[model samples]
Target: MMGQLYSVGRNIEAKVMKFVSKALIVSLMGASLLAGAAHAATTDKKIALSNNYAGNSWRQAMLKSFESVGKKAVADKVVAKVDVFTTADRAVPTQAAQIQNLILQRYNAIVLNASSPSALNGAVRQACSAGIIVVSFDSIVTEPCAWRITVDYNAMGRQQVAELARLQPKGGNLLEIRGLAGTSTDAKIHGGITEGLKNYPQFKVVRSVTGDWDQTTAQKNISAVLPSLPPIVGVVSQGGDGYGAAQAFAAARKPRPTIMLGNRQDELAWWQQQKQDGYRTWSASISPGISSFAFWVAQQILDGKPVPKDITIPYLAFTQENFEAELKAIPKGGVASKDYTQAGAIAIITKK
Candidate 1:
């Protein structure tokens, strides 16, 4: 009777142990599934890059940087996919239609270089209403709901002219090589240039021409107008035309003025060459890799990170002392001193 009782107790104990073991295994499986789901949520985001124009090398470089960073994000499984679309006509309506299509396609986020600041407000609002993230950089949007990633163009323009004034205290005729007319950046920069130049009365803007932020266009325009203008002692340029301006000076067999360099690699190379010939100048620009910064911002937002609506990335300036190092870091035909990582982008956020 004692042996039977002991055997019954042992059988009951074994059954309890088996039951507990099964319960533990089921609990672990549930935990694993939860973890997997969390990871999938983190990685399964779709990002789209909406470019307003690809008219210049800077824009081209910006798009390339975006693509490179997007590929890296995909490889790291941080984002599932990246889609790129550009409006060839560079019209606000065209870009608005593109954004509408992106909304219809259900992109998780859009990284945009807007054609106009206020023109895309409605389209951006629509995207936001649909629970999509929108982050604009470079040529940005005026939508209050969407995030903006950019440098202070006003400051940039002011600084460029300031630098030119420093180089030429008794500033002579300054040919202002402007970017695309009517764009917010161009207007801001132009305003800054005008404001900053007020302190230097000797400096005169002998001519102003729209380069459209294209080296070839700038070259053609400068070439056409070079014969008509007085000898320019300095140039206030909104980038993309410094090299072309230099080329025009060279072609005209005229002495190169105290030209402010844009952060273009070719410009840096030219600067280095000119430096060898006892010429000295400095350069500053809003990096073309700003698109990549915008990309990272979009990623952070999609990952549920709280990013500020307005993030100002400061302009990068390279002087004679560090131009060589800066030039070496960039790829052939790329911007100088650009940072493209998530941390790099995050480091520049002025608010929140």
Candidate 2:
């Protein structure tokens, strides 16, 4: 009986030792797992950015916004490296080549500021085929690319016309300084303006000319229109051309028109100059903060968050009510920064 008791005691002790060992092993594993997670939280992620137009202030601001946000994303362990490519002016072909280079480098992801919608399709396809996640900002690629970050350019145009209608109840003559001919923003903005004017049969589009995003060309167009017998009441122009219009107005010695639809960066400066000049007729603007919008889209791409294939940011319309405070807050270039944080990379659809 004593021997049986000894055997039973040994079996119980063995069971206790096994349980203690298993528990200790589990506790150590849990501790190691927590440490690994902490390390991951601080890890950096790398990204590549390619821009089509660096000459324009909007494009410059867009690039700056991307770099700043990308740095923040890395510090937060969202991303590490950022490879940037910039092409002079609006050169689509050069931009496509840059995309190929980024793909060759095997970047984790790519962000593009496309010039023409259809021109960059091949490059975008190549990037996706190479397994690099793609994001387009400011302008949509003509072909179906991953995601597009933009503002409601259509609404901007519509709003410009609506404001003009309010100012000139009796319809007046209008002139347009169009941006690059093939861009969707140009098309949408013009289309919206067309539709908005249909409401008033008296409002007529006297001339529509291509500025090619050139200020000189815009000034020339405005100069030509200034000599026309019918006095001009309003002008709707693409970015980088507002100052040119102002110059034309000054040269012509005509009171600044009743309405001027200026770009985002030029708004505050333009408004201040108008005020200083004591020009009350100089008012109305639609500003789409493209740089800040681009950063927001990049963050959405990084975190596995789902978003529409195409997204449009809201455009702000400046009026007398808010122009003063708005101008005061606006930066020199009217560029704004966006913040990025770690989130799951959204599963973007890539078609080859």
Candidate 3:
């Protein structure tokens, strides 16, 4: 009777072990499937890039970066479709209409470079209501429902003033070269510069010119106004205007001021040449590849990943020490940029 009891106990233990091993295998398989679902969630999604403007070199570079990334993701079956639409004019209404069209087309996601911060809120709201993801970069929208990849334009402006103070202790008259007049980027930077000037009262902005963020436009505007303005000790510009500002000063036959640069290849090359003549200044710009970053952010959202509504992208700055090396890395006729990979975008989103 004791031997019978012992045999029964051994049989029970073996059956329990077998059950536990099967349960463990099933649990592992379920976990693997969950992981796969996270990555494959967006494979059937269609994404669109709703660009408001592409008139400048930076804009062109941005489009190219998005194209490269978008094409690869489509080919790899990461997303079902990727399409681009740029308004011929940088008008809020045009973009609004475009957004409406995109909604009608039933795009799963829309990556945006908005024409205005607040003007497009209605369209953006409509998109959100339809269950589409909206991610804006560069010139971003102000709508609460949209995700923004923003730059600290205010901080950038303030830093420019601080850097100028260091470069020129005895501050004099300054010429402020602005970007596209109606953009949030323009407004924020101008506001920051105005605010920053409160601390550095010795520096006075004597005149302001709209460059439209283009070389020829900047040169034309600066040249037309240079004769009327006071002697500028420094020219603070909103990128893409630096090299053109230099040209305007040269044309006017005036003494060259310490002009702050944007990270265009031509601007960097011009700065490199001037460094030989004892000229000194710094360069900074938003990476054009931010379009690609925005693309991935949109994709990740479709993957059901949690992301912040407001995400700030770092502005790339080049000092006198680093400009030469950076210049070598940038392609001619393009702005400084670095494209994003899937892993890279995930890392950025995770960190944020």
Candidate 4:
């Protein structure tokens, strides 16, 4: 009887041991699955970007270029994602709000082309604190970001003014049309022009106003100044506004100003017009295309490549000597033809 009872006890103990071992195995497998999921989550990343405005041609070009090139580069990659936002008009606060929302969503990175530098300071600070890598382009933000990609605005400005001064060696009045209000690039370019003007004391900036970098706005502004215009020997305006200013001069039936300082595209067209009509108002200009360089900068950082704290791409100044050559060689618009929002996704998916 004692032996039988002992056998029964041993059988019960064996069953209990088997149950405990199976539970342990199940628990281990569950934990392993959870760990794998966490690992997968860590491998992929999110990027967010915002532009202050897309109202003008230049801004549109920028949007298109970034989307096109970035998409092509990352079509094969699987671990990356990009989110983009834009303020249709140059709305500073709206852009800031967009950045704040992106931070709340816990995006991994942000690219900012602020309409106004100082306006986005608070949002930029918040994003940096959240460990998001911030890349600034075109118009730089006031606060320090991870990287800034821009042209030499001041130099470009100075060069434009200097070119105009050369065109009017006798020291004529310079009618200056400015860019968007409160933008760093505007300040830099205008500042450079001021610096350049300092070199030529004879050149007087008789009238200056903000064209707001809009064609219609510039046309209106320039038209207002037309009554006092025949004295204006040269017109210095932002690229977009240059053609408008010229129109104002043309409408008055005055000899086109001796020299016009503006953007590359307008300068080329003006130079060609000058050749045909013997119009003297069109002179030299400096190229300040912001979109292509912006993409190049974003690509560098995304690829884990080192970039300068602030990268300044060289500008092309179109003068009579090389005007035709430069115009012919002007590279077709970079990535401006494609969809930009979808392009951001490609940036991350690229293997290298």
In angstroms, how far off is 122's CA in candidate 1? 3.4
For candidate 3, report its TM-score. Answer: 0.83
Task: Give each model's whole-structure lDDT.
Answer: 0.81, 0.62, 0.85, 0.62
What is the Cα-based lDDT of residue 234 in candidate 1? Answer: 91
lDDT of 2 by residue, 274-298 (tens): 6775643323332323543454455
Candidate 3 lDDT, 122-205, residue by residue in tens: 999999999999999987888998999988788888888988998988999999999887777888888878888899999999
Measured on C-alpha atoms, candidate 2 has an lDDT of: 0.62
lDDT, candidate 1, 179-238, per-residue tens: 987777789889999999897888989899988777889999999999888899998888
TM-score (C-alpha, index-matched) for candidate 4? 0.70
Off by over 4 Å in 4: 1-46, 76-79, 104-106, 259-261, 264-267, 278-289, 295-299, 302-308, 321-352
Model 1: lDDT of residue 1:
26
Index of the highest-TM-score prediction: 3
Supply every candidate's count of residue pairs whose N, Cα or C atoms clash at under 3 angstroms. Answer: 0, 12, 0, 4
TM-score of 2: 0.75
What TM-score, computed on C-alpha atoms, does each candidate reach? 0.81, 0.75, 0.83, 0.70
Q: Which window of 10 residues has the lowest lDDT sum in candidate 2?
A: 343-352
